[model samples]
Target chain A: MIRPIHAIQIFLIVAVITLVGNWVGMQQINPVDAALGMLILVAMVMAGWWLARVLPVPFPPIVFVSLLGILLTMPWTPGSEWIVSHTTQVNFLATTTPVLAFAGISIGKDLDKFAELGWRIIVVALVVFTGTFLGSAVIAQAMLRLTGQI
Target chain B: MAENEVVEREFEHNWKLYGIVLILTIIGELIGVRTFQVGPGTALLLPMLYALVIGMFLGPKFVKVVSEKDMSDASPLIVLSVLILVAKLGTTIGPNVPQLIGAGPALLMQEFGNLGTLILAMPVAVLLGFKREAIGATFSNAREGALAIIGDVYGLDSPEGRGVLGVYICGTIFGAIYNGIMSGFIASLNIFHPMAIGMASGVGSASMMSAAGGAAAAAIPEAADTILTFAAASNLVTSATGLYMMIFISIPLANLYLRILTGGRE
Candidate 1:
């Protein structure tokens, strides 16, 4: 687990990257609104991280962060409109860019190990990814069609 | 090999790592979202892809500009950074709670679709002559949760553990790229509704889900909100319950399936 301070620091840095991405890649949102939205998300994430640590159980911080997000933004919740509108300033894709960029940077360490796995695991990996994604999509499509919701 | 050891790297927190990432992100964002038609489906290339692909080139293997320790240091940050995306996706769910409720059954059951890995990958792995490793590789998408599960059950030094770790690295290395392209292509095919593809996007990793969900939505922009809502809801379901399901359901089923497919030869 990341120390809360380190997590917060990283979150702030990532939020800046995401803000630029949102403005350049997605839309030209006001920097103030975007930064405010990122700060709110960072606070929620830190709160969730703190809760996960202090709590007796061993639940992941992400579960708490997600629940907090959902609860705060629900229609009946107080100030949900502000939460929703501010958060809307942060595009989902924009937030993900930094994460994947970090992911790509970290892949070098695994290259040797990955090379040793050879062709078979690569084939299997591709298959597993394809199967899991396509299977769920197929099932959901059928179910939605059956439920008359599609 | 332990999960904690992987995540708890020395907290050097170098500036170069952050600097390179910022530059790559800016370049990627400037390129923005681009699309080209491919046969029936259209390929939607987002800034995320550009960042990832270019960042790969800057890795130690390709460019040697960054050291091995720098890469290790960045590992934990990836998991930490992803929380922002997870929280953002969660916010998408609040307004669409009713739509999520209406599609509840499909949302819940589509997780079983995760078991498709066992059905499809297990046979190929078995025929490829893997033994215990087949069980680890095919049991799940082999995310961090799967890594913990396999480590707990088989010890990370074991063959089964290596199998899961291999898949984990595979996911780490290329999962998002695959999801980005595949989700867009599948969405463009028009056989399945965008909502269904959204539900499918939650394959247990934040980056994969983000790429898959974002790409699918881009392919069908009219239904972007609906698609993203379902993706987030389904992904939350995966994050919360996916572990128990893997422990009680996926692992055992993969073991049994592998046994049958190998005809007890191993």
Candidate 2:
């Protein structure tokens, strides 16, 4: 687990990067608006992290973070409209760029281990990814059609 | 050295990583979204892909800009950074709660699709000469949760553990990229509803979900919000319920499948 201070620092850094990405890529959103949105997201994540630490429950911080987001914006909540409207300025895709950037930079330490796994595991991994995706897609298609949702 | 040189160097390495990621985000965002015509289907390439590829270029084995230590330092940051994305995706669910509930059955049933990996990958892994390792690798996507499952049951030193670990590393490396490209391609094929593709994007890993969900949104821009909301809801369900599914269904089924395929052959 990352220390709370370090996690906060990283979240701040990611927020700024995401703000920049939103400003550059999404002309529909103002950078200041997006920054405020980023602030709410960071706060929720930290609050969730704190909750995870304090609560006796063993669920990961993600569960709390997600639940917090849902609760805070559930239309019936007092500030749901404001929260929803502001956060819309931060496009979801823009948020992803920084996340994947970190993922990419972190890949180096695992390269040797990955290479040692040989071509077969690599093939199997790709197959696993493909099967999971296609299988769910097929099932979802059939179910939706049956329910007349599509 | 003041206090501890190692701690000081660790701070420096982390900042360097942060700096590089910041730079990559700017460059990637500037290039922005691109789409290509691959035969009849479209390939949607977003800024995240640019950031990812360029960051890989800075890998220790590549441009050598980052050391192995720097790489390790960046790992936890990846988990931290993804929290913001998770929070963002979660917010997408609140207003759409009714729609999410409406799709509940399909959402619940679609998780079985995760089993698709075991059925398809295990036989191939066996054919390719994997032994007991096939059970771990093909059993699931082997995310952190799945790794814990394997660790608890088989211990990380076992062949099954190694298999799970190997795929976990593979996922850490290329899972997002593969999902990004494939989701866009599949969505472009126009065979399934954007909603189905959205639920399918869950796949139980955050970064991969972001990539797949983003690509699905890009493909069917008309329904982008709904697609993302569905993806987030499905992903949350998978994450919440996936461990139980693995322990009860995936592991045993994978073992049975392997046994049937190998016929007890060494």
Candidate 3:
């Protein structure tokens, strides 16, 4: 069993790995600015964590932070420029590689449970994906026509 | 105090666990990244699919190199990375405000895709004799949003709760793949507006949304940044509305369908 960890430890571990990922792909990053950028991300994460805690609903931390970032960084907003400037140094693509990697590994954890559900689950999954795809396509087709953009 | 020492020791252990995840993530990411650099036909090698495939095959069921516990421990790292990416994606929205405004209701169309699925699939699931439990899985959204609603309405011990869990697991795995395919397929069609298609990529899951939108943007280089931002916003909308849709709309509608199928039988 994994040991229970302090929130600060989790924060440190995330921050360190993220910074390393950023550094690996970032060309000519100033170490000081890079560290500052990492801190900003940490603050954002903490802010999201705080919101998820206080909210009555089961809000996801990542979405909350993303929305908060979007609001503060809108071009007309006061700190938008600072956010835009610093985030550029973070190499967003570099972060995605790790995120997707972890997502894959994480989703696999439930395979046994998923497999136990039987073959019907596969059929259901197929139908669901088909519906979502065709539904999205139909809606997009209509919207595009209404906008006269197509 | 002795308690502080114990906590510190735990922190050290967590660090080690987290480190193992980072190493695996790097390997998965490297493979995924390399696929992007390959020839034109091989553009399918986005990190989303590649990394996931790596994780699934190399996970506990196979090589046993990456355990479920490791995945769980590293979840926070993945979440953090996603936040940063989403935030970065958000920052790009500044320049595309007008295009985003133009996306209009299309940004939300994908979330309703489930409604269409429920309408079509409910009858079939019912015919197949899906229990009230499987109906919850079959009819509802089956994501995090649907779990509490389904469980609350029918109780976790009820078939509805179990059904939702089954579908949720399947959805989590397959949803990502679907998003990747849809993005590329939508982009290739050319009949759909790139912006509109981008808006449709926001199917609630952040990583899936990112994967779909990223593929669209990569395929349509002219509107790359705009597509990313638009999809990100659309994802936000889906999540905000997801809970309500799952409860008031999807659940009631599901029950009605089931009732109609069984001649009003509970």
Report the C-alpha lDDT of model 2 over A1-150, residue by residue, as the tens digit.
Answer: 345777688788889988988888887777888888889999999998889889998666666777788778887889899999988888987887887677667655555544556878888898989888888888899999998887
TM-score of each: 0.69, 0.67, 0.58
Question: What's the CA error at residue B148 for candidate 2, in Å?
Answer: 14
User: DockQ of all candidates, in order?
Assistant: 0.45, 0.45, 0.38
Report the error of model 1 at residue A12, Å.
1.2
Across the candidates, what are chain A's individual TM-scores? Answer: 0.77, 0.76, 0.67
For candidate 1, lDDT tens digit of each residue in B1-266?
32366555545567898988888888989998776655433446667777866766676658887887677666666666777876887687676665556657889889889988889998888877678888888899987557545644654344675577677667766778788788989999999988899999988777789889998999999999988888888887776567668877997798788778878775
| lDDT score, candidate 2, position B127 | 91
Ranking by lDDT, best first?
A: 2, 1, 3
Better of 2 and 3 by DockQ: 2
Residue-wise lDDT of candidate 2 within B108-186, one digit each (tens)?
Answer: 8999988988878998899988888898899998875565456446544357755886777677667787888889889
The best candidate by TM-score is 1
Model 2 chain A poorest 10 in a row by lDDT? A107-116
TM match of model 3 to true structure: 0.58
